[model samples]
Target: MPRALSTPPVIAPGSLGGSPQPVLPVTGGLLLRPWEEADVPAFLSAYQDDEIRRWHTRRPSTEGQVQEWFEAYRQDWKHEKGGHWAITCDDDAEVLGRIALRGLDFDDGMAGVAYWVLPAARGASVAARGLRSLTTWALAEIGFHRLELDHSTRNHASCRVATKSGYLLEGTKRSAAVHDDGRHDMHLHACIRGH
Candidate 1:
């Protein structure tokens, strides 16, 4: 029989800072920081990509919708629900992509990570680097026992990123979620702390 789980302490906003957001530095001068209003254009552009639209459900067609999306990120962080970071180079502020920890559950001591890189930023390991950085922070700094990531079984690029970021494939959920094309089987991957 499984033992009763210990209650994890509630994570309060500003415990880490005025905002519970983290700015992570990645390879090649790329830095992951909180998404800003200035990044809306780049965010919209990245989402216009076929791959992003294919895999993710939320697609904002207008600039206002994009702003709403950014606002949602702020709300999430302010409430200690989750964090979203824009992937950008240090020299320029243009967003290259995004990475986020969503669906935070303190009771379970777990969260889900997701990421996407602009087409121009692909093939340079930007997603992998960002994922690794976030995973490390989530486990060490945030005290999460497990970090989970999932992608369509057909998304080979995501598979590579998950493996390269040290997340082991756990199993597949058949028809777990619906995508643009239809229901997709998702491969669940996870990295547990102290493993």
Candidate 2:
């Protein structure tokens, strides 16, 4: 059955300090939908970019690896785990970026978010809209209570986005993980649903 687009179950407008509406359809030159096999090439191209790879756990260095991840992305949605959508613009349908909800824990009412926009798409508010759409859907439709997003301490841009999007700046963990160069600090953000 196709998911109907309707006002989600229960989201108090004042929860986020404004009248929050359920996510609108893809507008403003961006379309977000589930991943497809053909999106492998686009995913590879996006992930391979040096700037994006800096925060990514592992970069897709080979076509075969990208192919595998692409398949896994499909399986994620199929198996009710978590996944992302290709951020395409309406004018050219250009796959300019991606936003994802991975590591879902349904029983605990939580999920982790990750996203990136091509450098060309930066400063265009694509990331904010993408995150809002996905998070609203996850909270109201998917019955999740809290959404979590973590970014490296040095990635101030991500921190600003998270805060601006109603995510509370929880705290920072020192030496939370190791990157290619050395230990990295992690800043965590979270949003809890309203009754």
Candidate 3:
């Protein structure tokens, strides 16, 4: 018989009190800050990319929907449900991408990460840098024991980002998620504390 898994310590309330989200500095003068209403146009534009649409299950199609999404992000933070940030370059008003720690389970000391870089920002290692910065903060500042990042198995680019950011490829979740085209096998990657 296999041993039962041990329950991890729960994260304390207000541990993630950086609501309105603090600006995290990344390589190349990039910053990860809270999403703002003014960014809605850029957010909508980024989702128009076929690659973004292919990998992300949800894409807001209208300005109102995008605003709603931003509101939800605020609510998530206010309720301590999760954290989301817009990746941008210093001295620029446009968003380069987005990275988030979602599916938060304080009792398990775990959370799931997700990201998307704009087409213009692809091949610049922007995603990897943002992922590394976020993971570091989540583990060190927020005290999460484990962070998981998963992507469609077919997304080789994302696989590279995950590995480059120090996430180890654990395994695959067979047909774990449904895409617009069909179901996708997800490649599961994780970074555990003290690893």
TM-score-based ranking, best first?
3, 1, 2
Which candidate gets the maximum TM-score versus the true structure?
3
Clashing pairs for predicted structure model 2, backbone only: none
> Mind giving the per-residue lDDT tens digits that candidate 3 earns over 89-180?
97887799999989887778999999999999999999999999999999988889999999999999999999999999999999999999
Cα RMSD (Å) between model 1 and the true structure? Answer: 3.6
Off by over 4 Å in 3: 1-8, 17-19
Pitting candidate 1 against candidate 2, the one with the higher lDDT is 1
Q: Model 3 Cα displacement at 141 (Å)?
A: 1.1
Tens-digit lDDT track for model 1 on 1-195? 934556535453354435457788887888999988888888888778999988888788888999998888888887767899998888989788899999887766789999999988899999999988888888887788899999999999999999999999999999998997899999999999999
* TM-score for each model: 0.91, 0.82, 0.93
Model 3, residue 114: distance off in Å is 0.2
Question: Over the full model, what C-alpha lDDT does candidate 3 score relative to the true structure?
Answer: 0.91
Error of 2 at 145 (Å): 0.3
Candidate models: Cα lDDT each: 0.87, 0.75, 0.91
Superposed model 2: Cα runs more than 4 Å off: 1-24
